[model samples]
Target: MSGERARILVVDDEKVIRDSCTRILTTEGHIIKSAENGNIGLEVFREFHPDLVLVDLKMPGKSGMDVLEEIESIDPNVVQIVITGYATVSSAVDAMKRGAYDFIPKPFTPEEILLIVGRGLEKRRLLLESEALKVEHERIRRNMISLVSHELRAPLAATVQYLEVILGGMAGEIPSEAKEMIVRCDIRLQEMLELLRKWLNLATFDSPKMAEHFQDISLSDIATESIELMKSLAEEKKISLILETSKDLPPIKGSKVSLEEIFNNLISNAIKYNKAGGWVKVILYGREEEVWVEISDNGSGIDEEHLSRIFDEFYRVDGRRNAPIKGSGLGLSIVKKMVDAHGGMIDVESKFGEGTTFRIGFPKFFQRQKEG
Candidate 1:
């Protein structure tokens, strides 16, 4: 049995063939439109907007081949089946290549017409169902990520606060050994918090709600703010944080939070992975069409092979994974998605012993800018 009633268009120059196809298919629970000539076939096809089209291979005026070409130009996804008395392997092959789903020979039986039409419609149903499943899977995956991250956030945040008080000796007198253990626990909890936050941010990154907050933003200002926030981390490792920017970088269009996030993730990683006394440089420049920001770090550089897959979700470079680097491997993944959403470009340059640099460019567009 067919999965669903499909809207079908029958385009054959012969009245008998077109009428027979319509009678057989319409009886099989489909809405059918029949056209008597090649030119009319193309017209009806566009107006019908059918799930399947049954077109003859040869016809007068425009010819079935010409109709097929026009139909392909209109919407290639519309399933087309060819009808022809001159059935040959070469002709069938040509028809199929030109986007025909199946071929019907002359004098096809009622059963044959139904069977072939049913097969083509079934293919359409499966393709739609497969795509729906994929969308559902992604929805579930993101929902789970969001749910877990938010649920764990409160307790983890409280834990960090209380741990801080205790470590600061505000709770009471504690032994040095116990303080050391608590510090370790606190570090682990902080790491977990970072992971949860990233997960939550990633889940909401591409949401339509977030897109509403986009506005013209200062690239240099955001870069300066991110640098200030990461200064302590860089100082702890004795790493130099350098900022080089053209003061006149043109404002680019994007969610301010998203742009700031890009700065945070890239700068944070540069500092985290750098050796003591290393330097991380952030450069912001403006081209005619877009604004570009580059974050470079002279630290433990990424390997050649790892560079390609670095932006992939939850994938860690072998060096970063084996080394003491701390991350959920989702930072660059988030960065890449955000860049793509802005219709921007991102590039990476690295050599194992030298260093790594990440450059990102955002398109310049002012669409009802707001003061931020």
Candidate 2:
């Protein structure tokens, strides 16, 4: 009553009761409609589209309990209230379970109905307002990501291209010291560009769009390819790279690029963090309903305090041990998002001074297709 006026529907068998409720509610500046039976009530509900409904428990033809259930199926957010002569605990509970907001007894006062209706309308308003806010927030987030990515990347990329031209001696020859400084600057700027790209990838990960590109892909092939890509980096550290796969493994439906990113990041990290003569092993196989891949390393393992926050965005482990290791800290976060998007699971195991292992499991392609 204190907020915006609402369209209200009252469904009952007795004409007197309908007229009484219609008269009482109409005076409070609320639009009202009434039906003499449950079946007629459903018809009026579809056309009138009231924000709140008042349904009588005992009715001819379709019962009020059935009406409550059908309304819930159509639109669960629509507020529902029950009207009954016998307001027994069991009946009230049944109506509530069927999605009734509240119930008023046969001999109730106008004030009682008005109070219940007002509460229901307020709840409806809040639900609508919350949904609107969520849409607006998502819009702002998307716009911000676009702005940052374009504003920083366009100029930096152009600068890098010009530097490449100079380094190629296209313009003229230069002193060795000057050329070295230019190379150093180029390296740092390239690092910045890579970091910016990773940040955008994590921020703009749209699962629905990614799902459109999904195809049946083999985890064994993905793992083998990722190992080949990481071999150069591992060789520099004298870290041995090994991949083992089970034959006749089942495939999974996923975006190839996202799955590649997951494996690349995990394998790269394993090699970068390992000591000389250490090893990184990738094992791929299939289990019931899922294809599992594990990457393990004999590297400096994560401490207990740092493990919890490793998957968080821009969260780098702090201390002297990790000081020399440079990273954007967005890799694991991106990996986690891509895994979840593909209907997969990822887990990590580590002991402080021993080693670390990462396991990823994806639902099999045939099973996913069946579920869909």
Which model scores highest in TM-score?
Answer: 2
Candidate that scores best on lDDT = 2
Model 1 local distance difference test score: 0.85
Could you give candidate 2's per-residue lDDT for residues 1-372 as a string of tens digits?
A: 236778999999988889988998898888999998888999999999988999999997899999999998887878999998898989999999999988888978889988988898888887778878999999998888878787888789899999999999998997999999999999989988988889889888888777877898988888888988988998899999998899998889988898999999999999888899999999999899899989999899999899988999988865353477778889999999999888888889999878999998888863233221
Residue-level lDDT tens digits of model 1 in 1-372? 256789999888789998888888878789999988888877777778888888888887887777887897887667788998898988988988887888989999999998898898887776667777999999998778856765688878988999999999998999999999999999989988988888777776653556577777888989999999999999999999999999777888778888888899999889988899899999989888888889999988898988899998889885455556767989999999888777788999998977899999888874433322
lDDT of 1 at 181: 96
Q: Runs in model 1 with CA error above 4 Å?
A: 1-19, 22-116, 161-176, 319-322, 366-372
What lDDT, from 0 to 1, does candidate 2 have?
A: 0.88
